[model samples]
Target: MHYLFWCKDNNTSTPQDMCWVSLRMREQHFPGHVLCWVSMRMRDHLFPSPWQRHDALRAEVGAQAGAADTARETSTALYPLIVRQGMDKYKVLEEWRAGSFGATCIVKEAVGDGRRFAVKKVECIDEHEANLALKEAMVLLNLQHPNICAYKEFFITWDNTISSLFLSLVMDVSDQGDLGGIVRLKRQLVKKMDETVIQMLLGQAIDVLVYIHKQKVLHRNLKPSNILLKDEDSFLLSDFVVETLAADEMKLKIRMDDECKLWMAPEALQFSYSEKSDVWSLGCVLLDMMTCSITNDAEVAALLQEIRLDPVCLENVLKTLVGKVGYSADLCQVLLQMLQIHPVQRATAIELMDVPYVKECLILVGSPLSGVKKTLPPGVSDELYEGGIEKALEFMQIYTDFEDAQISALRHLSWYIADQDGWLCIEEIIRLVVQAMKLHSDSLDIQLEGIWILRDLVSQALAHGLNEECFISNELITTLVRGMRSFLPNTGLLSQICSLMMMLSANEVAAELLGKAGVLQDTLKIMESSLENRELCLSCCGLLWSMAMTESHTRREWLVYAVPVIFNLVLKHLHDGQLVESACCSLWILCLKGCVVEEQTESISWALLESLHAHPQRPVLVKNACLALASLLRTSELAAFRVLVPVSGKNGIALIKEIYHLHSDDPEIVENMCLLFSEMAHYGDTRPEMLSQNMGPFMREIKVKFASTEEIVTLAESTLSKLET
Candidate 1:
């Protein structure tokens, strides 16, 4: 079947990339359209059409009960399945595993990028089963941890040959294989599993379980075969079948094979299951892994089965386990807690995380923060502080798919990096954050955490007077802009991203990179949408000001669009002094960039003066306001006349006088105020407005008060000369 698909995909198939959109497309469909395109003999086998659906079951019973188990006995090589179809047609490379109701295949994309994926096709015998299958697959979709296999896409189709409905799930492939395969190999070679390897597996798996159970979902099938090896140091729990077993009856499909019975909790055997059942199953998998060096598969299975009849036997078996290591005794104790026969007596995955040996594994895995609540003792903190960074990096590298872990590790890494000495690792942190963002592109939380880590890195560099080489890089600037583009409307995220961009813009090279990435336009878009969010506008204004310093060409198009919006925001958030100050800084930069359209200058001048009036006591706001007012008048002659009218009962001159009186000791304010008057004096229509407010005396006082300051003295002399003339 695969050979036939290869020939057709290369020679006969048209519509190169059809996406499976039907599962989500009740109103519109490409999901069903995808199934149709991937089917080799399109006329023979049944597949969903663009609008075709079996909303209700046509027949209740399967054409044959117990047929799925029999179907798995035959070689799937003779009947390869497409198993997946989406933005690209997936070509099944090999039949990885066949199950009672379905099969998982190793497949490569036939179009675009050629990425590999594992596609599982579950045969849903009827509409009800198909619906339940879809609901189950959706559960997997929500269970995206670094330790759980990542689900990509899924859709339901039909197989007319078997008269069966099939739901296909496409997930990320862990090429190294599953725990069962490794255990079997180690047993064949009589090699013991490394202690660190055991810790990696159990720690990561329990972490995954804690997250899953908190979400109120179950792994359903927790065995060595389901625990896939992502790499040497990572394991992913796969195949969530969503079997709903009640106290009396099991609802979903299950094969009562002997292997399943060997690992099942006694309560699970009685058709009752809970999260504790998963604990028992995981313990069995771990036990098998531990004892595989000395025991055969048959012997382990028999022992596991016998434990159900006599729970006391587990302690004896643990005592004789061959691969005992430093934490073996404690781990065996924890395993005893997990393998308890009664659900009420069993310790949950969460409780296991707190055990000494388990916490040691979590720390060794560089995930010290997941579900572990007590404050670390000073000894542990010191140990972690000294060696934790690399372990955290390892944790991130090993579990790249795990967003929660990524966030926890990153946040903790940030706490460790509070001092200047830690700033040197900014580049590595940036690289990891970028990679994590790309892997979890759809995760806003990861994206938020990534941006925050980058921001914290930049902030420490700035505060500590570190060189640009410490944090600013082309890649950092690009990621910042990319985040802005990706989450434009997420004000919480955008506010942080915008703030980071503002920090990056301080460096001329970093600012240029942002300019090239079209950062200014994104800032304008978010500011317009988030005018009501004071912090967002404040950060956006700061970003625009920084960009304007080195990006006049980039600012040319966006400045016009931003002017009215900034003017509006200034009026809306005048009570927020910092926001008002930022708006003033951004407006002046726009004026210097030659961005004044005469239609906007009048409104811009009024907003600046209003900011001064609203926060005249804030020295920084007064200083920025004076400079912004001067730049507006110097650039647009019309602005001088437009701002002559009183605003909030104070015209431009009156506001400047009040600001001068309030900030008399501030030389920056005195200098910029002189510049503001000089610009006004050059304009005939507004010059008397200054003189009539006793501007001549004000200029002399500024000149005398700031005589030693060259820029201030020059500005004061110039303003006095202009008013006298």
Candidate 2:
């Protein structure tokens, strides 16, 4: 049935403009032009050609659209031979599943029933090639079991070359949709399923596995999607394309699909498989069912270890076999034994069936006996076996995917909004993360995540927002300080913690709390470290700044003990521009209280002033140095003006003159400088002898810049006038 197509125009606004296709069918030689308009919204506003519009279905389905219905209508071309052999008599319905293997439906009369039955066909090949439906029909006919799907028939009779098949359909017994959907629904309806119901459903699955294995068959791909429950109790297994013959059976020449081989047993994955191999696959399926969602391999391994060690908490069992279907710890033990990597030691299906609890399940969860046909509900498709993790990850990795471990860790600590129950969840999550870390402490992912979680814990406690009581006062400080040293090279984590401390330690009460908590010394060591993370170092400086400037005199004394380290850092980095800026800010924070005469202020100023003259390129260093000296001179009440000359080394007055000149517009800097001058004026007034030596050059520079500087600058200039007035 060949057809020729021509062009048409489009009206809708989309990337592919509307393309009208003219068609001529070979059967009747009927000629007609169908308007198969592509979207008017091209890449931005241009239209794609007719062929491109037809090929974009896969991309368009997942994308957001406004004119999808119209686009679907415009793209349906008869020239593509819409009606093939077995499907010619049927009227095409809308698409059923737009999954990796596309499946569409049509209404066709049943051969035996002579009534209309919905026919679904999956196609991944050209119209001339055989479709997945044909292969599926051939594969399903060979299976024979009570819990397994029964093949009704196959259809592909056509005089012409077009060939398609139809077969019996299985009901979509997905709990909600997929496993994620089931988990979400369970969260909403957790109280609905009694312990008995859970046991029944799980037991039914076990029975289905047993029945499947007894037929000398290995359902290599056993998963949640393969196990469907009708009315939440009757479980049936379906969809077997990669089934393998038992190991002891005579070899059969069967074609295998390498792509679907991942779900096979580890031994089978490397070699041939036996019916016991199916048991290992069943273990993975059970893990998915219990977790209610798929997990990464690492998490799966972790959960398996926990279950092996303490199966009672992680794996529950049924005490009584009420119906015939039931659970017991012995059943789990048997299943675990079958999943052993050494196939020789693994329990055979016959051996597993003889277990007492297995016998109980067979009688309790009796298999369904009816062969009635049931129409599957909408929204479910047979594409459930997309791929095992390796394939999924391989597919996703061809592009790029991203996640942040830190954010994941912090969010793990989030609390519930109303009852503050989220704190308990956070507590459990932290313990899990910490345990995982203890097992793999060298793991960068775990360390990064742990640091962020600790930071959030501290922040949340200070905010008094989340009701989670995961952290005691001392525990919070201990966790944070330990994270700082352990998570090396992650300056972002360090800075984040430092910023959190700056906010939490701002109040005197919090600082006192932190000091007794033993974080104060660790924080001082971090501040004095020779590391080069300026932002993180500055954050440490900010915390100390908060502490020293805090109102508590006792806290101020603790800060004073660390002053020598601070003073040394200022001298060492006085020449390096970036470090100088940090050192200056630290010095400003430290000098909140005026230096006392008996304090080390005199020696500190001498050292800082010498560095300022030597590192002239560091303007910020000189600026802060002048400010610190001004603060100290003011502390002396102008009595220490005599030290200015020796400390400046002839350039000190010039630096001070420049500091006053450039920052004169800033009130704070100008006011501090004026205080220095006013104090010096008092010294000159008390003993006019000191003024004669150094006042000439300093007085001239002050006089020249007085009017241009500030009124306070002039007042300080006139205060020098008071000394000689």
Candidate 3:
């Protein structure tokens, strides 16, 4: 059979040199527009349709035939032109086409049972051209994936170092011809294919990447046109023009095309790529799959700008995709997790295997392993249908049949309990939280919810006078730590963990575990970097204050690190009343214990006394400062005592005057001030003389206003008696 398969290179112009090859076509009909590819190697031309074996060969066969005579002469020089039938199947095929990547015959020979097999002759113009073909052939032969075109055999005609490859033949045309042609023929069908079938094809492409990674290879040239889909199951991960050692290759083959760059990962554009980096490109594939509506730079740029501005809202994008595609929420969740910004955070093929929806494929193959059991506390029950803790636990289950319904119900319940300020539900809420923690042990959201529930429980326990030690355990600490480290870096959950640990400081065993867990360092490090993160800083201050207030013997050593940091933080962010109050409270606790540090006592004491003088907005600050001063005078006869005494007196007088002029209605302030001065007189060794001087005028003012401020006046009289003594 003779055939003229005309094809233009579109990029190259050698129309006069187009090959018209003759070959046996006894089995298959030669349909117009149906590409019949013929390769010299049986394996290259006869494997499968996805191989595009016949099509690729046909395209090459129609390329430059003017240089074909040169290729034929070279092939004849390398080996004798033998035309044996079955005995020379390999030899005759090589003789026909030599010194080329592989050529296409318009009428390709089908490897049918006992037919007249004929090889179409073809060639390349030069050795350089031939080497390009060899390189492509070697790469094709090396490649192995479900989506890739399979390479079968290579022919070296014993003529003149001429070579050709035989590959598995694909469809005559395409699913609807080339992508450009398909884009024109069936716009809606192609869009639907892009939405469904193409996703599977891209998934196959990613799977190919996973395989390449396993083999330590990289398919650096990845683009949509290279991704060919024939059907749901039949797809091709083709076009391996650039191959390199994934680890060793630093340089990449640059393409002039603009569309390919759109799907490339930022790291890939920079040429610093790894297997995980390919996962970023895969994420682009996923995003393309999710939103088939956008294809151009303007749309992509707009979407990316939105993503960049508020990356946390990526879940919303996934939710939108769910609205469009009617995909499972769990599947969307898996894809979103895979697209996480950090390469380390993105899912590998094996890690993707863990996603519940991804595991559905494995489930079809065999039954899934049961969800692993996590330890739950004794009071917590697992019976979801029963009453008590069991019934309450249903509110916290994240992915049950009633998860969406429970979210609304749980939100309402949480609000109702908090608004009413009911403390009775504390135990019940805690048990539900524990059960939730067990149910969604692997979920970040559930663990975060558990922490939040624990916070509410702590506040409720304190309000209801429940024992603080009741919640402390190895189990609680382990849960908190696991959740903290489970997500990389900080998830803004450390503050809650520190707050929970602070509540546990009243317990000896839990406090020790917290301290030994390097909880102190964690809090301090956060404080160091988190000076601007108000909530985190405040929580750190609170934790430090609790640690100091525990009254343990080891408090002094921790104070060496905690005290200075707390002081600097107070000075920097004094506008925050909670921070100020917490700083003063911490100072009060440290001073109440009277830590004896000979080297740093004077400076620490002066700083404390000055903080009292500089910030007098809250009475709690003054009261604690006075207590710290009194404790210092009582415990240490060092320079701190002498330095802190007169400073405390001046601060006290300043505070009293502020109260007298501004907050005179606050009788508690005047009463606490009088008591503070009285305590200083009896307990302070260095402040008696200064107190004696201030006591006269303070009493005189109180005496004149005795009727209006009788409680303060009475306290002042008592303080006067102490001063006289």
RMSD of each: 19.2, 28.6, 30.8
What tens-digit string does per-residue lDDT give for candidate 2 at 86-161? 4444444446643212233435443555334334333222222232334333434434333554444344222223
Model 3: per-residue Cα lDDT over 1-725, one tens digit each: 22222233335433333333443322123211112222121133242331133233334423423224443544521111112221233222233322111233222334444232223222333333333434344434434334564443333232222332122212122232233334333333435234444434434554566555765655555554445555634556544432222211222232123455555555555556666656665565556555544334356545643553356767777776678656567756766765666666667765665556655533332211223333334433333334433344454553332223333334444555555553555655655555445334455556665677677767777877876556655446545655554543453677777787777665656665565445666677668767777777777778887665432213245666666777677768766766777777776555554443556566656665566556666667765665555445445555434443566456434444554555455555555455555445554453465464566676667656655665556657766676666
Evaluation by TM-score, superior candidate among 2 and 3: 3
Q: Which ten residues in a row have the lowest lDDT in candidate 2?
A: 33-42
How would you encode candidate 1's per-residue C-alpha lDDT over 1-725 as one tens digit per residue?
11122113444334333221212212122233233212211121132321011110011002111222333443221122234433247777885576643578889888789899888876654545555556545555545456888777677665545555567888888778899898999989878777688888878888788877876787767888788888778888987755522221332236446776676788877767789988999988888888767788788888898877777798788777624423367778878898887789999988888788888887666563343323333343233344566766766786664566676677667667664355667678778887777555556887887887777777877877888766666555655655676687688898898888877766655765676567788788888888888878888888887776553225356876777888888878878887887788777656644566877788777777778778888877776676667767766787787567888986778777877887788776776777777778897766677788888888888778878888777777888888777
Please give the RMSD of candidate 1 to the true structure. 19.2
Candidate 2 positional error at 424, Å: 21
What are the lDDT scores of the predictions, listed in order? 0.68, 0.46, 0.50
The total of clashing pairs for model 1 equals 6
Q: Model 1, stretches more than 4 Å misplaced?
A: 1-387, 419-421, 552-555, 685-689
